[model samples]
Target: MSERVTPGHSGGLITLGTADALWAGLTNGSAVPTVSAACTCFPADVRAGYVLLGGRVVATVKAGGGQWGVPEMEVRRAAAELNVVKMDHGDLVRIGPFGGAPKQKQNDTAPLRWRQRIARELQELGDVERAAPSEGRLHHLAGIDWRVLVEETRDRTVRAWWLPRAVVRLLDAAEHAETRWLQAARTRQNSTAAAEPPSQRRQIRAAGGRQTTSPHSPTTAPRPYNGELKELLYSALSRKHGISRKVAEWMCAVCRTTPATVLDHCHEHGYVRAPVCQSCNTQERPDHLYSNDIRVASHYTRLFDTHNVDWLRHWHRCPGCRTRTTLPLPHLAAWTAYIACRSLRPTHRAPRGRKPCGVLRVSWTGSQNAPRSCLLTVTVDFCPSGEHRVLAQIPYREAAERFGTWLAETAPAVAAAAGPDRLDGLPTQPRPVIPDTNSDGQALF
Candidate 1:
């Protein structure tokens, strides 16, 4: 089972975190928005010599491990810089939304999952070459950075490597995943190489970087995301959004790969919702209540004039038996009047059984004595043509002063659709009964 991340989890979110966040960003088509290459690469070595001269490991730890004058302190400091928790887990671990004395164990499942998973994959893919891309190392075999390769049997257990733990986990997970996973990674790599002008690919090959492919490209259709792979993606999202890992997993299954920016997970299931941003999430979370603005009392009172407008208890049927009970219309405080501009549809409760909408015609009947006499018409053409067709024309005004005032007082529903009422006493129309319409918009049951 995948370990989950929670604010109150054993070590909080940190326990579920990897050494770096950048790896997650890169794989997700983002670079660490805040972290920089100059930041210390914890648990990983930084070839300072090559970094300064080679512009790679400008800020990293050193290998042949021992101690370089308070380097541990520097690593801890870097963890603070990244806003992740840092603590002494045999060798000083880092993870979480906040940095402090780590409350995690050396056997942290988050790291273990990556180490064991990759070791197994490498054993299966047959060990490839490990190098320091920044070190200018030359070797044959499908080249991989030493940052990810396990140094020895015991080394995998130690949480120390420059590459982000997430980066390592994903790279290895590919060994067992479908070809697309690896193909996506390769495509990313090739795209990066292609952008480097001239022959960056040739340079990589010259530096002993061998082209790699998926283990086996099946001629058959690609498989659905396996549970394990889904968990990994979920964890990445959890790390990003601070939601529980399980919630993220559920979101990945229901919504999409990424979580929303604010809520992060389904409010009900406690998992990632849908296309996370506000614009997309509107469609992503159809039933999701994004705000309480419509529910608050203050906002409600301003929406209606209790004297001029009133709500009748309306009920279609009872939740049980699906039959009309003693229930009346639920209380609504002129909810339709809260409609903001730019919205084609008015704000109202989603009705059940059928949608109640019709045309509102306001025409000038010409004048007997009044010249600007406008007539207001509220027409409901239910079913248009049906056995139970409902055609109702409401009261009209012959000497109406303005279209807005007449519609607001007599046909408030029409005015509410055209625009929201500005003040009290302005009419907020209610929907009239219409014929049944199925989900497909077909008229009648």
Candidate 2:
């Protein structure tokens, strides 16, 4: 046969009912008495009060009105016996008429015991500092004292999750020291840079100080006979003579020479021997003046010698006529012709003959053999040969009148051939006209 268990009964003992029912029965005086039939004899259907015995309940005899009750002395005795049984079994039990049971008292200290067990296990595993409360023990230890756990135990197996104030203070001190060291290093670098010598500093300046200095000017000395000396000489010459300095000097030097002797030498040597003081003549070779005509002729010869035949071809061609046969005279001869032409009257005509003076002669004739109203004469000679003669005879006024007529007739054609004049805005002058009259009394228009 199997043993049967009932409510509020376990391990062959009767246990107390719920706290609410037990308190109601005790206060209302309706307690029921439960007793083991094998142990003690009691009246049938007897009701009694119950009292606490450790974590269990026990029945007592009822008083009036069928109310269960317990005597103070019996209650004390049962309490002492239950205390002993509780210490022996680490719990309490109860016996009733229906069954023997265990106590239903809650074990309030169970969680703290489990917590201690877990902490020991973590320490053995070298992880106590990292251990957290288990789900089963969280509510149990929610209000427990932690002072003893914190003070007595040292968890060298795990690192602390939070930093201590002393370690933080040390870290702050190291950081400050590093910052100060860096500042000192920078200060030293600046001081060394500033201590450089001035010359070295200049070398390090931007672009080596090229911007600060100006370039040096070239060191050339001036030659003599500058503008000032030229102006002074010009003033002196102008004051002393009415001529330019160049002409005056030339005329003075020529005047010193014997004209007759100079003229003779000019024909033979093509130059006039320069006159000199007696002292200079004895000391130096004589200098001479080359004739302008010979100089001009020689210049052309040199030009022809140096240049090709094309240059000479260009020189002979008349730009206006576009004819190579019409040639210009040498520059010196042209200038002499121009001067002679300018000096004579336009009416005068050159004559042709040799006179008694051995020079060529020229005269101009009027309408008849009239004397003052008729003729004018010119004599031509060479300086060295002393040849003087009449060269030509013609009517002076008649020649001029004829030339004017020729000019009028040719001017338009010459002007058109020469293109526009650059300076005078006029055209080139024309060749003069010659007039011829016969025995008939008609004038040649």
Candidate 3:
């Protein structure tokens, strides 16, 4: 089982066994984003070195007696810097949305199943109450009041939730105990290298018989972070936005390897998220959100609205589902409108006693590079044995107006044909159909 980093299991230095396992896994088929010339070698000395990714050092590692270990603090620091999810088992690292299983279906029953599982786990730790779902309410040890929500997409649905700090601690403790139990049950491996004398253990250079010392020796290791300077920076940055002289003392929050120089903030809200290097600050500018891809737009909007806040503190909770989202008021209003428009699609139904046909689906498409040329395409014909038909092609900007007019006219009949609404008002836009037209707007046939 993989140990996830949470508020609970986030303490304690990583064990040698875990680090060794990680190193072996990474060096094999696993694709690490970064590497160094010295990476081919192992265990140069007891002093801590680094695990580099994308040419940047993300985490610090140490070796002793042919064993390796990572400091837990460094893991947390690196995770925040890289914007990638760290896995304690199975996979070494994940860069996308959170999930243990690949392409797992998240349906209506998923939340209930997870709730039961969590409740059972909690019962083992102590008393845990199961109460009615409440949006964004993180109850104390007296009860668990958080709600679990599913965000639907073309490929899958994602579940998001918030947990009380106390519950997280309890769960971490249980996981820790399980880890200890597993360690005790396993037999220890003998390490003859650990008993070897310093002189005998020396590694010889391929160029000559003389042994060469590693360039990344303890003397060359990065200096320790200044806690006092960090506190002062945090306090000062929270009050007003400006470049700090102390930035040289801190690593970039986006890339852990570089020294921070610029204080990055949300352009819309002007709230500081982190101190980042000049390159990251430039590349992640707020203007990138203007792309035609809703995914890209939504991602950047949320990034600016929530990234800094979430990283420095906790997630901003959604008003409806209470899923941890700190989306601003304007974006939230836009989201509500988008959801409403999406829910306008009527349910699909087949003739009585006849085989069922597919439902309506709507989507947007175009070259991401050319946002202005994006189109809103729709498909209507989904008969069992019949070929699909292209219903309409509306410009992206006119999608909502066109959809509203069309729905008002066709909704009653479509509703009557489809029977009652059963999908709980999820957006029902028809999936885009491949058009028969060519670049010149003429039919191919």
Choose the strongest candidate by lDDT: 3
lDDT for each residue of candidate 3 in 1-445, tens digit (9 for 90 to 100): 5333334555455653443333333333322221111222221122323332222232234355654455555434433333342322221111122333234343321211233344333433342234442353322210111222111122254322224222222222222222222222221111223666655553323221222233122211122233333212233465664336444345556545445555554322323445554434433322112222122122333333334333212111111111112232222223323333344333345566533233333345563123367564444335455656444455544543443333334333322322123334322331222232111111110
Local distance difference test scores for all models: 0.25, 0.25, 0.32
lDDT of 2 by residue, 1-445 (tens): 2222244432222212222232322223211121222111211111212222221223334346744333333333333432232111111111111112223333332211222332333334454345454433321111111211321222473222111222212222222222233333345445545997545432111121211111111112212211121112222333554332222122112113211111101111111122211111111111111111111112232233332132222222223211212112222122222222324312222356422232222333332213246543444544235545443343434433433343234343432333223223111332121232211111111
What TM-score does prediction 2 earn?
0.13
lDDT value, candidate 2, whole model? 0.25
Q: Which ten residues in a row have the lowest lDDT in candidate 3?
A: 436-445
Instruction: State the lDDT of candidate 1 residue by residue for 1-445, as single tens digits.
Output: 3222333332211211222332222223222122222222322222211111010111222224432211222223333332331212122111211122233433311212233433343443443343333333221111122233233222363322223332222222222222223344356556666687655542211112333322122222222222332112222465664343222222222223222222222221122222122212222211101111112122233123331232111011111101111111111111221221113221223446543333211212222122234222222222223323222211223112233353366436534444322223321331221222211111110
Per-prediction TM-score to the true structure, in the order listed: 0.18, 0.13, 0.25
Off by over 4 Å in 2: 1-311, 316-318, 328-382, 388-445
RMSD vs true structure, all candidates: 24.0, 67.8, 21.2
Ranking by TM-score: 3, 1, 2
